[model samples]
Target: MIFSVNSKVLEKVLSKVYPAVPTRTPMPILENFLFQIEEGKLTITATDMEITLRSAIFIDSTDNAEMVVPAKLLYDIVRSLGDTLIQFQIDIDNNKMQLSTDNGTYNIGYAASSDFPSIPNVNHDKKFSLSAKQLKKALDQTAFAVSKEAIRPAMMGLLFEFNIDGLRFVATDGHRLVRYSLLSEKSEIPEQYVVPERATSVLSKLL
Candidate 1:
């Protein structure tokens, strides 16, 4: 299928998802972004198995198709194009995709979408909807006290506990245990969840 999309909009959405793509991965396809075209919308997704980033942009297209293209290569091609409309065509038989811009044309190889693992469908019925600022305050207060030691898995992360009175975050590394709490009128936490320090850092920045 062939389609045309605004290069600037594509780049902006890709930038948000690129942070989740890892430099090294067991499956080469994990380092790539999955592109799905349906009707007049283009869906781009990137993942490292644990975290998935997805965004949809409207484009001009005739048919629907999907492919897995290297994220880095796609980013480089889009960056090279200078504020011009880009025409993208995919040839499934040859496993090749072509990108055309005002300056020039480029072709790259891509893996079939079937080879890539399916993205997980997580069901979050009881989610806390907090503003970025409020979440930032909660994370900032406890992140500093999170354990740096990886020897013990449980001690290497921050603990999130919600109760009838409030929500609490705890972290320790054998030396010091720091706890931060915030009262909430609308919380019904059954149990506590432990989130890794690295994951906490990423979540903090993204929020």
Candidate 2:
């Protein structure tokens, strides 16, 4: 398969999804990004078994392909490249990815795409949208308060409480607690859930 994309554009997109990659794990497959091209768009996904993040970039492709490439290596290489177009050639049978730019060409080996973990499809019975600025502010204010202790399931992560009054986020590590609340003009949910610390870290980057 062959495709060409701008170096700077791709690098910027890669950084956004890099947080979801597992830096250390027994499953080596989680260290790579699942690269897929379909319907004329290229998508890269990273997952640490708990949270999965996907980002996309427009590309020039004649054939659709999917593969798994070393996340750190790929990100490091592309991030240093200049604002120029880079052509990518993947040899699925041999398990390799070849990148060619105006200045030079680079070749890297990759793992079997089939070995990448399957990303789950979530169906939330309820849904709500929050602005990006608000999300960033909320996570930043309360993330530090999340409990590090794992003994208590409730204290292990951030607690989100929703009610007619408003929405609230609570986090505690047994010694201290933090609460951040947001007002909702329309009341739709009265729910509570503990978002894992790892997931909150990723969400913070996304915002």
Q: lDDT tens string, model 2, 44-153?
A: 99989888889998787757888899999999999888799999988888988899998899999988778998887888878867788887788899989887776877
Give lDDT: candidate 1, residue 204: 84
Task: List runs of model 2 lying over 4 Å from the truth.
Answer: none
Instruction: Give the candidate number with the greatest lDDT.
Output: 2
- lDDT for position 197 in model 1: 77
Give the count of colliding residue pairs in each prediction.
0, 0
Clashes by residue pair, model 1: none
Q: Each candidate: RMSD to true structure?
A: 2.2, 1.6
Model 1 per-residue lDDT tens digits across residues 10-100: 8988887787788898888899989888988888898887667788999888688888989998998897786889898889889899998
